[model samples]
Target chain A: MNYTDVFGEPTRGKYVIAGINVGMILRKDWTTHQQARDYLCDFDGEPQIVEGIDDEFIREKHKEYPHLSLADCEYMWTGAHFCEELLKFDGFMLHASAVVYKERAYLFSAPSGTGKSTHTKQWLDAFGEDAYILNDDKPVIRLLNGKAVVFGTPWSGKTDQNRNAGVLLGGICFLERADENWIKPVGAKDAAFGILNQTIRPGDKKRLVKLLELLDNVIKTTGVFRMGCTISTDAAIMSYDAMKGETRA
Target chain B: MKVKSDFVLKEVAGQWIVAPSGDASISFNAMITLNDSGAFLWKTLEGGASEEELVSALLGEYEVSEETARAGVRNFVEKIREANLLDD
Candidate 1:
């Protein structure tokens, strides 16, 4: 079945995500989600067209995830297709709340409902003008000139907080709820494991290899920390101080 | 028995990591790290070597005795088997 025949004239939206130009093509009937639309930008140069998943594949996915809504299916298809295209340009999506602080990005990653967003919010509240949300969720990390930089994506989670800018990744912190605030440096192996847990691992073998390699480089270049804390400004300050080497306590 | 086809061994930052790929990675849900001896044995076992061959290879590379090599290989194999990364 021809994609164009089924979806009709596709609505093209161009976005510059993580320094790469992406042109999203979808059925005109289906509107781009608001989260992604917020980051949309005009791309003057040649853009890579991210075609929507074919109907047959969508049917199979619907069968696999019977409870998903039509909108869910469309979002999953578009995200998967765009991510696959982005991988070709050495970019991969990470499930984390990224905040820009002191001209660098610090990513807070944890399982859903584990307070990643809350912790980043604390950072913003504490730092005031010094910190801003790069992306509340699903930021794209790309390897540029041997540095792992984080860029805001349209797929930012619930808050829809994101900017189209990119920042050099300075650190990553895995959050765990605890009685008191504390932070410690994590080893490379542990850091990789945390990153893998938060990253969207592709099923394709070639893409999976690239993901693993990129993750390794990210761990090697960026500071990794494991923070245990409660929901307070102290949690944010403790982590920030540890990461910045301002204080050991 | 051998290391499963779906698992790939990667050396990152001077450490060895075994990561699942393809469909297995989707459900495997975990990664395993191997020490120097485990990495050596894993690479050796990729060719489907025997226990005795593994012990011999271990002794050739390290300063351990035959008995130590055998014990190390047995322990490594047992750990991988528990992780379901070996096709026995």
Candidate 2:
């Protein structure tokens, strides 16, 4: 079957994420998820096509899930497809809450319900206008000209915090709950595991390889830390100072 | 016994990491890292080497005695077995 037979006539929408112009083509009248709508860019200039989900693949995924609606299936397929496609351009999705501070991006990653979002909120409270959430979840990170950059994606989680922007990645921190706020540097080997635990491991061999390569580059360039902290402004301040190489008082 | 076909060994940033690929990766949650000698053994086992062959390869590659090589192979094989990366 041809592409048209599976996805019908394609309706194209252009979006720029992580410095890549993606032309997303979907079935006619089927809108993308709400979170991605804000990133819609003018359909000009050369763009990469994000392959539409085929009926057979959708059916197979639905059979495995057995509970998701057709729309949910489309959303999941789009996200997965986008991630795989982005890998070709040296990009991958990171499951973390990213915030912008001092014109740089800081990512806080943890398991679900691990207070990643709450910790970023503390940054906002402490820094006021100096800090803001770039993406609450699933931001796209890319390696460009030997620098790792972070970009806001449309797949931000429940908080719906995202901006159509990019920043040079400053640091990545793994979060753990604790009574007192503390942050410490971690080695590359330990940081690799921490990043892998939060990354979405791809089922495709080529994509997984590319993802690992990109992650290795990120580890080499970015400062990685493990922060144990309470949900207080002090946690944000302490982590901020630690990331900036300040000695703990 | 042999290394499972789905496991792919990759060298990233001068470190060796083993991860599952294709459908197996969907449920394979753990990624294993190996040192230089461990990586050599892994490659040797992928060719379906037996315990004796592994020990022989270790001895040839490193300046170790046969007894030490045998003991090292035994420990390495046991570790991979616990990780479920071997098909016995």
Candidate 3:
């Protein structure tokens, strides 16, 4: 019942994504101002949602309360938005979900309703616990020591699966709904565009270029792919193989 | 203006190339090289090379006489300065 205690459970995992130690706290509810404050302040996790009668509900609905700082509220929600790890791991967060297979992580990127969650679930069921979801909604990626590493985060769009960070990145897969499933290597320009499409940041041309630079480094190292698939693990498996190469360790 | 004496240069992240003690870091996509005269002028600017010293070094290293070196080095030093690749 203690949100803070759950979130601030000593961060026993190997890595901490965003601000929350995602390992201990799966999909759960936090329902009081004290609980919300404790949860937010404890691990410095952002307050993602104050809904479901948790804390700070001025009215009976999930709508924003006027007295509450909407700006701060939104900020709180995104506190643990992505992998903000490693000192200068300058990278952008995308509207994507990723899974870790072996030591390498594979990213399933898309805007909303583009089958990110559905594909992630397929990967999980297909690979079972062998594959782990980084963040189903807002996954973070950064370039560190000249490499792009993906981090597991706490923000899930009603997703139940939870864990700490993953290892290095496998590859980035930009999803497209297709009649049949197929995977293809993305060209450098297309790859850059794919990354850019999912990029989340406020900016002008200069900032966008900076983000592009970070993304360029990621594509240079991680490789990008375009995947067309039906709602089946077979497609997920194909996407995985394209990113991960052969099956099994 | 240029420095006087030995300066080393290095490039980082396809961005800038700079000397350890040099006052500037030059960013160019292509590799920048210095000719004998330019190298000599660059060398003379070791302890913060000056425009005159750069010319003198160019004269010493190239076939040009001191006067020509002075003018050429002066122009070249201006370019280097504009590129933000050298100390004043």
Candidate 4:
């Protein structure tokens, strides 16, 4: 018997994020068309938000996202706390658009409005079904059995475009808008700074240490690049070729 | 000078990066990258060394001359100081 049995609703739920079962209480009913709707299930556990932020924090968030409903604010809070707790499981969220091409997941990270989604769309247009978005925003990279695998989660930012999928992370590219499409492999230190700019910065020593160790493993194991790209499909082909060793055929 | 308290130096793929750890990050929002000699100096700073100690450590480790090592240490220490990452 679960909370759905006693409460007659999905008040208690769990999601399989990055291969971890995360159970948390559903504070309110979300409207239809939520991506989270794809993964909600009845679960029995004490899986509330891990050291969840206080209501005052959510209230402050309301000012930041005043256009959203209270339920959305709760969702945002839950996602944040979830990423922080993810450190314990050897995973952390990279603020990137994850795309799977040839069974490998490539993540493109940039500041908001820098066209991570737009670049992915171009890949979709150029490659068609050969490439698909795993998550348009917020993909989890977890070191599993010595491999850095990227997982799509339910709480993707803005657009509700995500698949409950996990694939080996092919590479990570920090994107920048440029007149011409050019991509180059950056050294690990420069890539690390770019990485820090995109993800949630842990405030405690424990989580910070964990996050850095995970990054050390990931940096050694993955290809890191700085891509200066345009909005054309040529940009897509160029980046894909550079990162995956695949050229448009 | 010592490595600042509540900050950490991590090596990722042979490159060293220093950033604030724990609560130190709240105020400082930057990560300083270090070259090989700079990383060695940072490791020496962990034990709270003077500039001369840092120069000697570099001389003992690298094939570079004392002048070259001093210039490298000064360059690195200046950068961290500008970033406010050193404990003096």
Candidate 5:
């Protein structure tokens, strides 16, 4: 399964993601991005598997989203592997729209087509200069010294919306569409179930252990909530107010 | 009865979460969270313990009486069995 033999010397690039230097080997058609390229250095990155990824694995992933190009599948495969590796550093990626307001990051996670983007857009419109999308999709969370921190990454879906930023995670809210806007606090146990749907689960038992441990810290250290919202600025403000721990007037 | 190999239990932040993994991961959406006593029964059942054996372990581990131990083991065993997480 040595990819170097199958495809000539893979494109090796070092990039800092989630504040960890990763020397990722991208094969044939997989691509890199400028966002991470800014953090390039000679510092040694962790060594990871470059050849064990199977064709059946890529095809199975592609079957879930057929619109993805071969290159997208290749890159997605690498991203999943990076996430698996990120587990060791107390980090893992969440499929969420992370927004930065007042310098703190708030992540909103949900299943696709669930208006995760539309709701976050309301935050942008509501707070023009004060709010920005840190990563529109797939932001990385790392528990640093018992504090949850969210970091922007290059593989931010098709929107390409991301910042080379790491902000203290303020809260993580699982979003849902509702006729009216409302928010409520969620316990850590319930947060685990909501989070499991949005994050990549590793294949083996050992890494799965790391993931659960990190997940425990992330949920415990940050505020977790569930919000039923509509695509309105008021809904955004309501969620923002609750997540930011601001008192309602 | 015994716990299936498809499921793995681990303690995270003093809580026990049981989730299906490997090939059985895709088809199920159920995840079981257990307390200290439930986790003990799960670890014991991993090697296949009888109902009486589970009750005895519960009695020995905690300072509970026989009736309470029997009820605790009964309730915990029924739950895993219902979740199909046990190989009975």
Candidate 6:
């Protein structure tokens, strides 16, 4: 039997991201009115402040939401709002889409519409069910003992797949699609820039320095790459193979 | 002096982020993180102050020459403006 039943409940699935323990609890009720009853979840003293939901409301809200929900949380929970709290609690949210391939997490991050979801789907189609998708939207990145670890939260893009969490960043991809498929390794400075851009934070001189420092530490331990590819499965496989080589390009 | 100015800012999500019209973005990646000096400069010039006002404030606060202060502030302001972080 699966140790975890559903998201948002006490189970083996509960784990810590950074120093913050993201505990989940799930509730299911058939009544449409019953769904409307809002529940409150707290992160330390800060409340999730979730409004009640009924089945229709949930379905409707789901349709209107910009992001996906693995469980039944609101899509408004962004990395910027939570990462600082998570960081203060010793955790941080990663600003990227994540998928688990061969039990390893691969992240695609860059500016919006840089094919993060498209790349994730490409990998999924290429690998079939052999690969699992964690988050196609906002995935959390936490540092464990100074090593970068990626977590799959319930939050995702339009895809409703609520896969469980995974640890260890197999590789990070900063996408820049071209006419041809190619995977290039990036150096610390470029990698730092790419990763820092994908991090959930504010922009200014001081923050830039801090982001630079954060990305520097993250890229030093976790390898970084620039994936220039097409929408082909071959390109997806090429990226996977490239990352497996484990050498900076 | 008719010195010109622009928006004030900080870094969020690894990009040069800023605040416009005195309101900041709600997302973490959208929030601008500023250092003490940058924050100070940002707030001072945030009221849409002119270049002269900005330079004068910097001169008074940081013990820097007018040319140096103007040049440095201009460069900083230029970077943020290029990123479109300014309000108006």
Flag regions of model 3 displaced more than 4 Å.
A1-88, A204-206, A245-249, B1-88
Highest-scoring model, DockQ: 4
Pairs in steric clash, model 2: none
DockQ of each: 0.56, 0.46, 0.03, 0.60, 0.47, 0.12
RMSD of each: 3.2, 3.7, 11.9, 4.4, 3.8, 8.8
Quote the RMSD, in angstroms, for model 5: 3.8
| Residue A93's lDDT in candidate 6 | 56
Summing lDDT over every window of 10 consecutive residues in candidate 4 chain B, give the lowest-scoring window.
B21-30
Model 6 C-alpha lDDT per residue in residues A1-249, reported as the tens digit of each score: 122323223221233333354443223341211221221123463232222222344445567763655333333432234554554433455567787877678888867887888887888899998887777777767666676677665445555454546567788888877899988877654664455456554433344344444555566667678878898898889989888646222
* Candidate 2 lDDT over residue span A97-193, tens digit each: 9998998888999999999999999999999998989999888889998888899986676566899898888888999999888888887567776
Q: Candidate 3: which docking quality band?
A: incorrect
Docking quality class, candidate 1: medium
lDDT digits (tens) for residues A64-104 of candidate 5: 88998645776676677777778778889999999999878
Q: Which candidate, 5 or 6, would have the higher DockQ against the true structure?
A: 5
Lowest-scoring 10 consecutive residues by lDDT in candidate 6 chain A? Answer: A30-39
lDDT of 4 at A136: 95
lDDT of candidate 2 at residue A217, scale 0 to 100: 85
| Candidate 2 segments whose C-alpha is farther than 4 A from its true place | A1-11, A26-33, A43-46, A54-70, A245-249, B26-29
Off by over 4 Å in 6: A1-19, A22-73, A78-80, A202-213, A245-249, B1-88
When summed lDDT is taken over every stretch of 10 residues in candidate 5 chain A, the lowest stretch is: A45-54
Tell me the TM-score of chain B in each candidate.
Answer: 0.91, 0.90, 0.54, 0.89, 0.92, 0.59
Runs of candidate 4 with Cα error greater than 4 angstroms are: A1-10, A31-33, A41-57, A63-68, A245-249, B22-29, B56-72
Task: Predict model 6's lDDT versus the native.
Answer: 0.57
TM-score for each predicted model, relative to the true structure: 0.89, 0.87, 0.53, 0.85, 0.86, 0.55
